[model samples]
Target: MKVLDLQCAHQHVFEGWFGSEDDFHQQLERGLVSCPLCGDLRVEKKLSAPRLNLRAAREESSATRPEGVTLSNHPAQAELVELQGRMLKAMREIMTSTEDVGERFAEQARAMHHGEIERRNIRGQTSAAVALELLEEGVEVMPLPMLPAVKDTLQ
Candidate 1:
């Protein structure tokens, strides 16, 4: 397996695993590779160093390193990466748990609120005005910004 660092046009960095360099190229050419954050297909491979399993070196470094010290040179970047991962995981959970009502979100929500339909977990697109109206009418609704990648299954 080959692990490569990749970046999309939006500058979201992620990793891609492939059987070989040829396999990666083939997938890219076929438009199968996309940004997990925004689903952008304009991806490029970034320069990455090979992974080395230097257990003794790691143990020595950690022994002398200060407490609370992270491995990343940029702490903020590491935090951002962590946050992105969390957000992606949460989005995936939401997508899997909620029923998509599409543009009929408002209608369905209103029905459920009025006892015309059963209340259940749901998610969909609605205009800002409609969403506000729903809230005003005591229909509980929360806006979730749906990522394009979250709408499709990622390879």
Candidate 2:
């Protein structure tokens, strides 16, 4: 397996695994590769050094470093990446657990809130005005940015 660093037009960095270089190219040509954050199709491979598991070297370096000090040169970038991963994980969980009510989001939410329909987890699109109206009516609702990549399984 080949792991390659990729960046989309939106500058969201991610990793793609492929059987070979040709396989990666083939997928890119077919528009299968996409940014997980924004679902942008314009992706490019980034220069990345090969990962080496040097446990002894890591141990020696850690011994010299103070406790609570991180090894990442770009700490902010590392934190951002970690945050993005967490957001993606939470999004995946929400997507899997909720029923997509589509444009009927407001109606369904209202119905469930008033006990007219069975309460259940749901997700969908609604205008800002409608969402506010729902909230005013005491119907709990939250907006979730739906990325195209989240709507479909990534290759």
Ten-residue stretch with the least lDDT total in model 1: 68-77
TM-score of 2: 0.76
Candidate 2 residue pairs in clash (backbone atoms < 3 Å): none
Candidate 1, residue 118: lDDT = 91
For every model in order, what is the number of clashing pairs? 0, 0
Tens digits of per-residue lDDT, candidate 1, 77-151, equal 456667777888889999999999899999999999999999999999999999999999999999987787676
Q: Report the C-alpha lDDT of model 2 over 83-142, residue by residue, as the tens digit.
A: 878888789889999999999999999999999999999999999999999999999999
Itemize residue pairs with steric clashes in candidate 1: none
- Which regions of candidate 2 fall more than 4 Å away from where they truly are? 54-73, 151-155
Question: What's the lDDT for all of these models?
Answer: 0.84, 0.85
